[model samples]
Target: MYSVVVEANVQYEKESFTIVGLPVVPIKKSKECILSYQHTLGIDITMKKITIHLSPADASPPSQPN
Candidate 1:
């Protein structure tokens, strides 16, 4: 099985949420879910810029040795 690393960075700049490293549409669409959960947890991050990076966005099979 392949593995992927997820990293996040929140900046105090213009309110925006971006997911890099070639995320799928569902991953990109998670902002709404995240916001909802944050609201439920009483966490206020409305003015922060949230960036999520998925390391090794493209996963390929291991190289075959000769």
Candidate 2:
């Protein structure tokens, strides 16, 4: 199994969160994960903007044989 490193940056900017250097699917899901975790911990991040980046941006998951 291969491991990937993800970097997260939190900024005090307009309410927006983004995941860079990743495909559309994971980017979309990232928000869900963040929101879910924050909700579980009762942490309010409504006013903050969060950004996440995946290292080795070109890296991709191995393909599966059908």
Candidate 3:
């Protein structure tokens, strides 16, 4: 297991993050993808502040954006 924090997208808002309890490069990339979309497709937001956690075979952390 591992813990990795990364900024991600929200409900058409700025970016949050996903705390990876068992993260890797791909996991971090995934979070980045969400952040990008949020900055592009989602609403107008730019808050690189969030946390992500990864478990057995997935990442789970706090709720949506802050």
TM-score of 3: 0.35
The lDDT for every candidate, in the order shown, is: 0.73, 0.73, 0.55
lDDT of 2 by residue, 1-66 (tens): 335567888878788777776678876776687678879999766777888776453577557999
Count clashing residue pairs in model 1. Answer: 0
TM-scores vs. true structure, each candidate: 0.55, 0.61, 0.35
Off by over 4 Å in 3: 1-18, 44-48, 54-66
Compare the candidates by TM-score and give the number of the best one: 2
Instruction: Estimate candidate 3's alpha-carbon lDDT, on a 0 to 1 scale.
Output: 0.55
Task: For candidate 1, give the lDDT of residue 63.
Answer: 78
lDDT of 1: 0.73
Ranking by TM-score: 2, 1, 3
Better of 2 and 3 by lDDT: 2
Clashes of 3: 14
Question: Which portions of model 2 miss their true places by more than 4 Å?
Answer: 56-66
